[model samples]
Target: MADINEPVDVLIIGGGASGAAVAWSLAETKMRIVCLEQGDWIKNEDFPSTGRDWEARQFGDFAISPNRRKLAADYPINEDDSPIKVANFNGVGGGTILYAGHFPRFHPSDFRVKTLDGVADDWPIDYATLEPFFELNDKMTGVAALEGDPAYPPKPAVMPPLPLGRSGEVIGEAMNKLGWHWWPSDAAINTQEYEGRAPCINLGHCGSGCAQGAKATTDGTYWPEAIRARVEVRHRCRVRRIETNEDDMATGAFYVDPDGVERFQPAEIVIVACNGIGTPRLLLNSASERFPDGLCNSSGMLGKNLMFHPYSQVRGHVDEKLEGYMGPRIGTWSMQFYETDPERDFKRGYCYQFSRGYGPVATAVNGMADGIIPWGAGHHDAFGRMFDHSLGMLAICEDLPEEINRVTIDPDLCDSDGIPAPKITYRLSENSKRMLEHSVARGKEILQAAGARDITSKTIFPAAGWHLMGTARMGTDPKTSVVNEWGRSHDVRNLFIVDGSVFVTSGGVNPTSTIQAIALYVADQIKNRIYELFD
Candidate 1:
């Protein structure tokens, strides 16, 4: 057993985007804060610079999937031949360090889904309650967007949008002719300068690691401010379990330090921000005599109702003469059908998009020309044809919540640490199936409108489930949800979660914005009532 470390006022597990945001939000308080991260701090020099080299960092020597064979659905089942992406950081910032950097907020209807659309469960709190937090998060994260972009709602972006190249312009013009709503995208990347970070240099490898320091990775944007305000981030520490007393208040947690020392870190408050996959696993693993079914699981919904934003995109070849890999990753989106229109069979809607960034390997993968076959000599010729002229369009569809789709620790699969890993069993609902079909159909229409001679679209989603969410969802009802509106676990008063895991619904938009907003809101909750929670 590890020795017991001196108890702090608060102990946080997983220093990713969720944990880091919470720490930054609470930095001004007078509490001794210590964050335990399982991954080490990696600098820009530590990452691969080339597109093909993405395989190294995306699936590095340290990357480990809970599933011995496959991680949930983000990637394919056989990863040996594919790019290694057991990828998620355990460091100061987590996956934000290597994300595509898109920052789209959830529509207002995303919050009260059950009430409005009569579909999945409603969030414990409504969109109005989270609106301020979203705005606060946008400014805090230094998002680049336009104030009056007709595409999305009219909110003032913190920074100017990085311009789209000829690719987006041509498509945007064509979209206009077809009466589609399109505009420059909102991104966590810097357009010029804000709060000490420089503007983006257009390196185009935002997914691997932004060496120019323009992309707003959590470590780059939040951790520095947090540390300066006295938040202590303990790197390479793996939290094993969270302990609570009979009163249902969290006491502390156990972990293994990088030095191989076993230690118990006690705290009055505990926040679990270990992303979607890690959070539920920790809660289920933290079983005790007091709460054998898992902490905060009185409703038996802690590890159930899993949600994954399974994405499917249409890859096409535009015949126009333009530069593809010349600018930032994911520059713009079309919001023509982002709202609930009965014309669309699904209760929710998907965002159609046109983005103009390319990595060498990513560009090579989908660069087949119009008249070319996809294999052998023909593949090489087609690959060369669209190498520079190619741009991509994708649609992010919403996956409705389902109780049967779950992430449970695979009894047979254990990592080197002897800890049981997560085994995800998921099947889409009829609603999501129709949504994918509709989104793909719209994508094909847009491609044809853009005058692409040929279109290669994928309406089927196989492994894009990396955006796992709602497994340990927050709600007003204890019987149906795991966390409260404030993100507190219903069964354990001292335990709180602030990540995608606590989401009640998977919004069509990328989750980073709401994830950070929730992190800030939960951090304030911890700060205002430390005494009530601890004593």
Candidate 2:
């Protein structure tokens, strides 16, 4: 037991979305479980927004991109070949640390993309199989939502909805006039203090890390419960490879500790919860004589079919002051165009989210980028023209899984731990482009209907890579996918994956809720079939 290669019943890698959820789900069991995270625990005081210079810090140190953050725990991602930038955090909470807590579930149509739309491949499991897990996770994480949305099957009780500020009212009214479906957002943010956490104070900078603990990050929610249940969490341990036995069965993981010493943790079952890119990176790097291609790449689909939501935003400047700087950044949303229509050239549809404009400093900086604010005396007036009066709508466009879009290891680039960085090679498909174009046009119309004069729209939103999906997709056939419906590796039964990488289709919504649901569902399957998992 004193050996570094101490054996355990289960070992989970990456303490992010699915990692934390799986740990929490399996905590009540008698099995010994341990999770390894590359980043350290985030301190409440480390949130920049709590300080006076937070706005400046937001652009500098607190930027969402891993390359920009450049923290000790961060692993560099080569995004030169990708149109959409990869933005994620390397901490116990993972990307949830900077996410806006937008927790939208994948639509039912999302699972049947290949059958219904003849575009992307369909998921092995349907929404019905995962619906119970979705509700269970919502109860655990405390979602802020409203009832009576025609889009969903009766949603279980969520916390009282977050306040829809003037911006949401404007967008809601516009959607009503246009005969579109709009609903208060399904967010992980607390409104009436659920569990032990406090309610959101309307701080307006949720993307910069919520200092008030109102936003439900994994570190703030699942990790605490998991730790209490005796799940050992080791921080600052970077996993280098997944080791396999002579029969090509997964034994455990080899990782590098913070003290620059190599360590091994043997386990009966090894689960990979590293997001789309990181999962592929670890697998591709763990090559052996038995599986020279990769541990689970016998199908040659390990790092293929990378999908990201192609997103864009339309910002409108209203005549009346809307105080756009206040309230949650993303609250109300419209899903009228969620289902694909034959009239539209796109295969799948997109969702529209009403967003509050940035702070005064961010607004001024944005104006400078667009040349709205010049160098001289014109700066102040141009900045004030859109300071507190601007409200925007973001269109989350569905991206199909294309074989060409993938995650590969960068041979030349290595991280701080001497591990090869993951290289993303992604581009929006023609279908995606058409979907984004149509969504932007509709967004401009909604902004105009809301009594806005100056409106600006773009094809690509700068910071929109928060939701990563695909790469190691789930399917029925071992030849076509990396994992089965239960998230078990088709080649190596002892290995499992419970992250966005198992997503077959890129749903036109935020993936945090769906990611957690998948994890919970997979964990339940493991619990039921513990003895037969590797059979």
Candidate 3:
């Protein structure tokens, strides 16, 4: 491989959303930054959408879950104890390569879940502190939406919102009739060709990787600027552990290069940007004699408090042909129930994402499997009814952190590199169940209002662990948290975390935007305190 013994001023692991953003932000300081990505860079041509069998390809190579995709660079996750399956990517762009690009910001109230609802612990930092960074990230990523969303505070202008396609228009009309809060969604996809990227062509399979290069995958957005700024991004480099010095401070990382050669890259400072699960996995695997439990896990919360948004989905089939497969998959959503309500039985709330349903093959298969369409004589008729008439709503339920729900090392399972895989032990809390029940009922009502002849809802989507968070929470108390407000490790002075693992609470919406904003904020924090960071 390349020069493994090179000294770097800053070493970042995982070139995903947060890693790329942090690299770009720190690149402004002209620091020697290097990022190690477990997977290779995903070229736009690698997307399967250009072929006729793209729909079937999703079941194999483009599958969201690493276990299903089984790419050489992916690691195995032991999800036997969890109801929701783990879904993530291992490429240079990370999950952004497969995310739907829904860029909704976390509500202000999300930071104070304990102070307001007496549930999870409150974050050390508030929403106001992150607002500026959010705006900066929004501009950098080309958010496509409007201001004046009642659900959120005032913000900068965005590109014109995605068109409310036939499905969205119908659902919006229903919500308006019902007097519920609804708005066009904020998306990371470019609408007017910002930052040398082409506008979205309404690619149908955004979740399977945006082949058009319109969606703001980090490979297209941040990494380009970071490399231009002289940041070295090493792909297919799987970091197994962080090597600490005699003082128990991070000094370097040990990883395996693409050719299965072990290498060491020394650094003055180390930033772990691997997402929620991957971050903790690396830390736990880096156990040393000075810190036997795990590096930076002096609080004994290294893999505790695992949180994934409990998600549910409902699909409706109407009589009209809506061309549901022609546009973006999850463009428009409603936050009417995003905030807390005294009348609701649950403590927190959930958001509803209204969008066109899956492709014809997926819809038909799901319909036939669920017995919604009979197999004998009624198959053709049922398939015909659902082919172009399917619309769906996803309910992202807020997940409260509990010590019992956690990510631990699987003694029996390991990745290709022989590192202990992450074992998730999670179950939905009562509040989450109640919130999902309410959401499903409301979703059915909205669908019925849209003239849907048949409707179906599932309490939990089997493979909906996209938003992993809170494995290593942030707080001011060193005894209760792993990192400080600025993502600096309490136990290791030179170590920092800039990923979803530092989340205090899981919000009711997508976590990618918040993850990036926090990364940028942490990068600024490190930049301002570079000389005195470890003091």
Candidate 4:
């Protein structure tokens, strides 16, 4: 028996990026909204950047992989079967806590992949429908970028772009020499003071959590406003499953509190803002007598079509003593191969996200791993040369949805709360392999053109499973999708999803900005149809 709580108008799960956006968007309605988060809020001082061992903490407490962190809030993910392991954060701001803050909007053509490229399914909603929401989200998050980039349509910037440091200058000149398109990356990091947050002070490791409050994580951006609007966010409450009524409607959810007690939260509507992998895990765990195959999984698409941006990296050292390890990881990007081409070996192309070099510890560790630095006396000399002179680019390859790659509940694995853990079974597609080859070749060319020597490449960066998407995809047809265009579950009328799980196609760019936009759009739709929301 579980303790019953007061019913609310709406219940939101996972108070990360999408969850924060949805809560803030729906705050105007004055509904009794409550959000459940597994992890507690992280203090700014507790962030690794404030400490001396900041670089080492990235491989330990703040490591992106939940399995390595194994915190109380984190559930174990069985990624032994997959090559690219999952990288996520279970805290209030989710992955944004450790993200590079590289925000990029999906190209308009990204929405019509199937229509134009004759591969993958097109999104139920287009970039046009979500444009206003994107703009609104950018304003709220204080996105910094330069306008009039040839890669995307005219988009507004709330602040000036982050300065393109030495690495960006080198990459920019290299791309220009090759006649490729390069642009300052749209970043959620503050370049100037905005909304009470200070500007970035050239902090080297933005991924280990920004102590300066410069990066736009949801906890700093939307959560404050939402909290002021009376949206209740309950921390350390790990939801075990969503509870459903006999009518096949979502009533609320069953969760474990901080004191380790099972409780039931009743609500008029339920919205799942868990990311792609987490969303499917929750849905599949919420099985009932009437819905034995898992809630709203009649189409058998609940945990299928798992997609990750298969990533590859090409790095090299230049002769110049460049300050390449002292700013945001991604300063600029090349969209030269973002769209599809008839002459390409693969269908969809990839974006070249040029990044600064790593910190001292990271450089030494990576250099040793790649056999670039020896273990003895020569190690010091090798480390010193590669410390500040290295530059790299990640190939953010577009991973098309495939039914074979999926998230399944592990038969033997469970989390701290005894919830079944998610098992990832994924493989790099043939198209992705070919795309990586092309990306590596192009990346090497750019590095060589920049007078870089000792160039190295990783065809498949195994730990680069940062972008998780496409399991519970959105579409018009119920037979082919889990949710409708507006993010409502096909079977459960009062249930909605506003996370990357609703993504129909994984674009070549990072999904956080787009994920928040979709969440805001879904919130807008829920507000508009409040009267007939259950219909």
Candidate numbers sorted by lDDT from highest down: 4, 3, 2, 1
Question: What's the lDDT for residue 66 in model 4?
Answer: 93
lDDT (CA) for every model shown? 0.75, 0.89, 0.90, 0.93
Tens-digit per-residue lDDT, 1-535, candidate 1? 6699899987889888889889888878868899998877878766665434654544443233323323221221222321212335446678787677888888777887788788887777766777888899988899998778764446778988878778878778778778888888888999898899888887776766777788898888889989999999998788778888778788899887877787899997898998877887888888889888877788988767777765667756676666656567688887777677877677878786577635445555445332444766677776666666666677777878877877677666554455566666677678877888887887777777777755666665443445668888988888888888788877777788999999988988888898988888888777777677533
Candidate 3 residue runs with Cα over 4 Å from true position: 1-4
Candidate 3 has a TM-score of 0.98
Number of the candidate with higher lDDT, 2 or 3? 3
Q: Each model's RMSD to truth, in Å?
A: 3.6, 1.5, 1.3, 0.7
TM-score of each: 0.92, 0.98, 0.98, 0.99
Ordered from best to worst TM-score, the candidate numbers read 4, 3, 2, 1
User: Candidate 2 at residue 500, lDDT?
Assistant: 97
Determine which window of 10 residues in candidate 2 has minimal summed lDDT: 1-10
Clashes of each: 4, 0, 0, 0
lDDT for each residue of candidate 2 in 356-420, tens digit (9 for 90 to 100):
87898888887777666678988778777888888988899888888999999998999998999
lDDT of 4 by residue, 1-535 (tens): 9999999999999999999999999999999999999998999999998889998899999999899999999999999989999999998998899899989988898999999999999999999999999999999999999998988888888999988987889999999999999999999999999999999998878998999989999999999999999999999999999988889999999999999999999999999988989999999999889889888798999989999999899999998887756888878988999899989999988898889998888999999999998899899989888989999899999999999999999999999999999999999899999999999999999999999987899999988898889999999999999999999999999999999988888988899999999999999999999888888
Candidate 1 residue pairs that clash: 2-262, 39-90, 73-463, 73-465
- Tell me the lDDT of candidate 4: 0.93
